[model samples]
Target: MQGKAGNAYLINELVRLVYLTYHVQDAGYGDTDVVVYARAEAALERCLQRAEREQVWRLEPDDAPMFEAILRQAGRQPA
Candidate 1:
């Protein structure tokens, strides 16, 4: 999984996978950017909430820069 995000292209692939599997439509990559934006934001928020509740960084720094990077790759900014 770490290797899967070593570069920009890989990150794009990861996002594409998420968008496709979860049916997250693309903005410029499709007809409507608004729909994709809403769905993708919802998906990302769910993931973040889950991570927080699960204490996903117990043994780590808790900064979660990795997840942040993933968000950046998906064309989303961190909160």
Candidate 2:
């Protein structure tokens, strides 16, 4: 039960990460305020780190390039 709950939490984090990435990308491209963009970027970075720490899933090959691009744009190294 505990393991299942942990898995569920990780899954939620993954979903959050996906949404954060999209928000960050949109904020970056749009005329959004810098503070808003920075906040979204920071959230995305935190999510990325959390997902990497879980080590339960890897980005698909098709997704890797875009993910890396986002990290680079955020001035972070792809982990």
Candidate 3:
């Protein structure tokens, strides 16, 4: 993976896991689950930070709308 491609991959994977993690939980998650989602959001944020620093490719046009779409699909908001 080179610059943009690498960054895009990281973002894509993080978003996928974030969405998956939320959906796999019970209909009503407890405090622990909140912690879990928080961690996932944090991880996504970290990757996004790297993407900015590394000049990663765009998440929209060129690739999937990993950030907004994934969160929306999971009824989550970026924190």
Name the best candidate (by TM-score): 3
TM-score of each model, in listed order:
0.32, 0.33, 0.44
Instruction: After superposing candidate 2 on the true structure, give the runs of residues whose Cα lies further than 4 Å from its correct spot.
Output: 1-6, 29-79
Q: Write model 3 residue lDDT over 18-71, tens digit each, in one string.
A: 666465444443223455566557655655776688666433332334334444
Worst 10 contiguous positions by lDDT, candidate 2: 1-10
Candidate 1 lDDT, 1-79, residue by residue in tens = 2312233354345456455533433323323334444555454454445446763312123324444444444554221
What are the lDDT scores of the predictions, listed in order? 0.41, 0.46, 0.52
**Residue 39 accuracy (lDDT) in model 3:** 56
User: Higher TM-score: candidate 1 or 2?
Assistant: 2
> With candidate 2 superimposed using the best TM-score fit, by how many Å does residue 25's alpha carbon deviate from the native?
0.5
